[model samples]
Target: MTRIGLSPLAWLDDVEVQRRAAGLRRSLRTRPPVGAELDLASNDYLGLAQHPRVLDGGVAALRTWGAGSTGSRLVTGNTELHEVFEQELAAFVGAASALVFSSGYTANLGAVVALSGPGSLLVSDALTHASLVDACRLSRARVVVTPHADASAVEAALAGRAEERAVVVTDSVFSADGTLAPLRALHDACRRQGALLIVDEAHGLGVRGTGGRGLLHEVGLAGAPDVVMTTTLSKALGSQGGVVLGPTAVRDHLIDAARPFIFDTGLAPAAVGAARAALQVLIDEPWRAQRVLDHAATLAALCDVAEVPASAVVSVILGEPEVALAAAAACAQRGVRVGCFRPPTVPAGTSRLRLTARASLSDEEMALARDVLTDVLAAR
Candidate 1:
């Protein structure tokens, strides 16, 4: 037996193997133009991502604080803007406190890993985002992935795991299918089992609950001592960052123990400012929440009218991955941008076009989207 050299490392290829197994992988496109066609694929629920106010707020922060945080939160990076944003966020989301992170992915990673460790058991939904799944892996906790949105399955996983601390984690709105988790039922189960419930309301924050307070509050679990929620500012807020909100003690624990917050550079001042502004906008325009939900239902109804099986995402089911990709391509070609959920991203045999709705969409835009979607699906 001999060790492989750097030259042999070049021959060792997982990229080609994955390509053969999963087809050609997609690459990121550079900053897309706002003028490019109708967009039903982005997570900009309130259409505030490119709003003048948001841009101006971000620009002001950038000018005041520079381009990046000088250091991590525990270091010199903790800015006054970050503090203000967190306080505002906590108040808006009905949490005792909130801790902001550089990205929502890092926020989930830090929260999950810090809250549940080697002697802990983490039960998560099968349909959760990749970030949560990765956090479970990094936590070194005993991970039990239950059936998607099945509270009973979750309960069963915690039935006899008394030796270790257990936490039930789930996404409030699953990204791929746009389905919601049974937050109340999961909370009940966790409460019964003496476990903590961590709800990922990344998609839910701007789209669900009363006035977009989120699923946890809507289900009467927000202020609960045992219920913790994490959300992304990049979505509804149209800013880039993540925050974990819960009781003061839990937040204090995260401040001291969460590696992402302590070790990574604090969220940029611009992002914090933008998030603050976005939250303020939400407070002023409470109707935005209802608009997005209404848009989602409208998309679903149009799919139904077109004889397409639609879920919370209003996806046009394309049996084959290639078909889904092609459909997405066709939509893009027709100046209607949409999302394509395929293998690995979506569960096996559930490839489809995932179209998200926004409060900013005019009635005519939605009608155009429906027409394009129906035509695309029919052609497929």
Candidate 2:
């Protein structure tokens, strides 16, 4: 008779037990393409996903190019559509040049790692999106995490760094809480330290700045030699892609050096076309940006949140993960859809209902949302 060790894979059962006990389990649910639910959970802030022109743009590309990009961008996937869209994006954002990636996550990885490495210092905002946090870890630079949205902390990190090269990365609008960053102050600190600044405008594009040109353009730092910006087409442009905008040299460098860009497939033709059409729409309908902001304010008031959201996101912290989950269920049961964020997505004890405002929501829709949210929150 002998004692045997637990099976190698059996530990997962213990982990599951711990997760359930901590109330951290998560699962996904499907929704009909056309649903009765009032959606404030999606990232389609401008509500362009169903816009006729946006659909037509994607469809036209599909008819011509098929579904997938045939190969990596460097080899066979480069198309006229991609080049044109890159140019359009650069002009729209007032950048000297632009390069597109398959996703915002890849775009952040490319820009951060290409701009930094060993002997360089990377200063990152603690509250940045997870994508950026992952990018910093992969950069192989002397990494320093500063207080959330504190430009002075960034300055100190950059100023005292022994490395000759430095890069500061932040989100223009924090994704979880929708807090705005001090872009101006951050840029000034980077300038003083002669460090490069990278701002991810994933939440700010098509929802901030005049004409949805993005927070970098809004702050007059769009084409600065020491500055770069990354954004997603999925969130604002109603398409699936990512972009890095800055000096032409940076684009060239990424094309040669960035592992994510060099090895990854180019963005699909349909996404490029949809993004281009969506950009034109944004140019024509600049008011959509302000309208979404207005809608966020309305949601804040309805939920009794004190401050109006800085971007389209509004977070209503409901304590433990289980509490937030129940509240989200309550909203869905009442014909409204909102996002529920728990641990890993957010910190412990700060689980929340993350609401996103859409520009295309009709007045009646807004009223419905107000009633549902008011009742749901009041119950909580």
Candidate 3:
């Protein structure tokens, strides 16, 4: 074959250089199956990822269902396990029905696209998750991005829109900043405008509300006719997959109209089993939710973070990508694992150490974390 003089892919090299210059390049590190480092980087808020029951559930499902889902859910992939999960999940969250998906991103995509089309309007929060942003883009609706957590802005968008069908989307708890959206106010606005409210409870389900039923449940909007909620099993549930909980009509419509739910393979048997087990664990140990929030508050205090975080995430802004990376490295060297978020994941000049609180973190681990984080911050 003739040697290509200049590959079209060469532009990637320049992009990589630019990223490095801005300290925005990202790389992954391989982690052992088990480690000695104190884990403040994971989203295992309830510490159920390695729970014996959760593990057993996954193992048993894997043995029974084999390795894969086999086909799309509409085909051979739907199983008794998936059906049971949907029913239990819907009941637990006070929804009339639920639809499971392979991931939270896909769930949001399906919900947004299925609910809104060319004649509809979608009002989204400016600081919602990337998945939601992508969903908004793919929705084929008239999209208006409102100021973060501004219910008035959402109302205005709805009021000004010509479309009769409108959907206002927001995260129950913001992922990066660990702040809560005004769900009750948003619901009032949606009701006033005859619109539907979609709340992403991925960060709220296991960390907010009474007994972790989620923010919507806490606010009495769980079974509201105009409200739809989506959440992930990978975070607080310490498993994998996503679910959309809403009215029975919404679920039926999604089954027939949502492309992601219809075209994608069903969630793996092991994930469904694990999530079901974790949900049961949450039900039995409701106090675990409060423990996670308490741990997060302790972590935030140790870092002098001013914001009272509403969930398990505690962000300590370091103001520069290199600074945040160095801080995370320092924590890791001290046997404390913390997450460093740079540009793209966070705003420029607001790079941060994103610490997650787990209910299973021991007193000894907490003390160690406090000391390590203090030293890291003092060094700055």
Candidate 4:
């Protein structure tokens, strides 16, 4: 055999070594179908991922529509299931319309890029999700990143922007810290500056607001002319895909202009059906949202964390990547699974364990969580 030359990607080995040295390496673990571990790491806030009705919805859709969407939504991929899901989702969230995407990331990309372009200004929160950050990059808009949840900063940016067209972007509930953005204040600011507010409700939907209609709806901003919202079905809905909710004109415009929406294949039938089922569950069982919040409060109290979470996310800052990793491992040893977040996911020196509360967690599971978290934190 002929000797092969050194590969061009050989430098990636050094990068991996650096990551390991910095304690920032990440790996995936395949979870068992039925595990003994108490799940605190997953985003299944409402716990509908394993619900019988939700599963049945997916199964029925799979039998009827096959596994794939078949093509882009502009083509043969636009099914009756998609239209029905969209209509139901829009009505449930009090939006004028909704456009579904393959994932939350792509939905953010499509909404941000399509709404703002060269000569427009995008005022994004500093702690906004990475999806929105990437969308801002792709937008080619003059981007101004303000301090986290600071409405004044957003207002100032919007007021000072040279461009007449502006969009103020923020997360309704920040994913890492679980703190809420001042939605009312931000909306008022946007209104004064004639700017549109784009809120990513990924963490807020099915966890916050009245019956999980979302934070915007709770604040009376849903269906507002100047507001746009994007959310995920994979999180609270316990399914897969994303939706951009706003005015009818915005939906039509995205249909025509958004590259991600135009080029990407539509969401599969199973996800659409499952998400619709989950939405209905949320509607019928409003208490599920409250249960998750109560659970999060209980976990936070047991963890002795200073800040109370506004949603299902409860973060316990450990100040170092290695320490957070060790803490998570300690919890795992006690049959509790928690997420360890480090730099890039979170800022350096603020690495932490991210725990998500589930509505379906039993009393025994809650007790176990409290005990495990208390023991782990005490050991530190």
Best by lDDT: 4
Give all TM-scores, in the order shown: 0.94, 0.97, 0.98, 0.98
Give the per-residue Cα lDDT of candidate 3 at 162: 95
Q: Candidates sorted by TM-score, descending order?
A: 3, 4, 2, 1
Q: What TM-score, to 2 decimals, does candidate 4 have? A: 0.98
What digit string (tens of lDDT, one per residue) describes model 1 on residues 241-348? Answer: 999998999889998889888989888899988888888888888899888877888887766635322222566667677778888989888888888887888766
After superposition, candidate 2 runs with Cα above 4 Å error: 1-7
Q: List the residue pairs that clash in candidate 1.
A: none
lDDT by residue (1-380, candidate 3, tens digit) is: 77669797989999999999999888888788996799999989999999999999998999999779999899999999999999998898899999999999999999989999889999999999998999989989999999999999999999998998999999999988888999999999999999999999999998888889999999899899999999999999999999999999999999999999999998999999999999999999999999999999999998998877789999999999999999999999999999998879888999999999999999999999999999999997
Residue-level error in angstroms, candidate 3, position 131: 0.8
Model 1's alpha-carbon lDDT is 0.84
Clashing residue pairs in candidate 3 (N, C-alpha, C atoms within 3 angstroms): none
State the C-alpha lDDT per candidate: 0.84, 0.92, 0.93, 0.94
